[model samples]
Target: MSTKALDAQPKFAQIKQYIIDNIRAGTWHENQRVPSENELAEQFNVSRMTARRALSELTDTGILTRSQGLGTFVASFKSQSSLLEIKNIADEVRLRNGHYSCTVLSLESMAAVAPIAIALGVEVDSQVYRSVLIHNENDTPLQVEERFVNPTLAGDYLQQDFADFTPHEYLSHVAPLTEARHTVEAIMPSNEVCQWLGLFNEEPCLQVIRRTWSAEGIVSFARLISPGSKYRLGGHLTFKKKQP
Candidate 1:
């Protein structure tokens, strides 16, 4: 597009694009305040109303947050997770504009036991990376993820800092997931499960056993447990006929 064509666009639209570009470039990060409308107006050589229009539009779209006494800051990201597919807890929390956090209870290289080896479709005593993770949304504990990973899928599993990234996120980047299966059910909490999720002995827990696959073979098997009283399983799907 020519400079004249660009200049001909609506001032608010241009300002919005400029702000978006800065955000995409990491010049502005989450919770970081952007320039005030007065500052933006002066910088863009536009009226305050035009500048506010850009900020207002972004705020409405869940990009920016506005406060009465304090200045506007970038809104936290939050979204719903996919129940039918492998979803990263961090990504799901952020999409819903909620804070996502994790505690890595354990990350170790261990020999897969009989059940774990069967789940991964590998020989008994095969090497695997195992981790225990507690995922939280907005500071409240939600789920405990006990996962056994095929080392071939995520060779660097023990090195990465899970506090900054989730195993699901890491696996997606390293090993492409071709498919996944999830089975959810409610069960009486075990001693370990009760402690990890802060559930009482009598309380039942919602458990989701997920098996993910890659082109090579089974990628990882995860047992996700959460307090039944606190969370209910959810899913999103579209109804359609099978293609011929």
Candidate 2:
């Protein structure tokens, strides 16, 4: 096999790009084992850690798979998810060639409760907006989104038609993103959430809670419940050096 000459880029980044390019070029077929870390280090004249970093990054990016005793192999590019990136459910379903639809359950203005106040970094009883929507894909219920918006930041949210547009698309254009926190868990859906999602009483669901901040402060908080059968979560992870 012909190997490309390494450039002056960072060791890990160069390694990652090399693997990606090779995979894209079909030099390394899916599920096919690549060179060993020591062999790669020798070829690149870099340390083992650098080679490991490259392989780890590819593994995290779903380009490679590391088996316990079978060694590292190229990963299959099937149903790969952009979990690391914040995605709109409607858009994701469309990408999968599935029909997508949503029903708005509630959209109103209210006062932030204690937990909400703490989440939004606002005073108790501050004005907030709440919305609940159930999303379906190909006629199968998928996700139920229960969202709270800090009206002080996200203005006139209740007036918008969410059925035509997603909150993520709207807020991304309106608010400058600053930070985000995501919490994921598996649980049984509540009676109301289950009814909205068309899930049986014993069916399990995936709960995802996301809080987003803008330049003004916490702008939105959403609790999403997804039917386990219809939804699966996937993402990539990377490690970076600390800045001084």
Per-candidate TM-score against the hidden true structure: 0.64, 0.65
Q: Model 2: runs farther than 4 Å from truth?
A: 1-82, 238-244
**Candidate 2 overall lDDT versus native:** 0.80
Estimate, for each residue in 97-190, the C-alpha lDDT of model 1 and write its tens digit: 4588998899998998999999999889988999999998878778899999999878899999999999888898898899899898888888
Give the clash count for model 2.
0
Residue pairs with colliding backbones in model 2 are none
Worst 10 residues of 1 by lDDT: 76-85
lDDT of each: 0.82, 0.80
Superposed model 1: Cα runs more than 4 Å off = 1-81, 240-244
Tens-place lDDT per residue, model 2, 46-86, is 99999998888777645678998888998765424354778
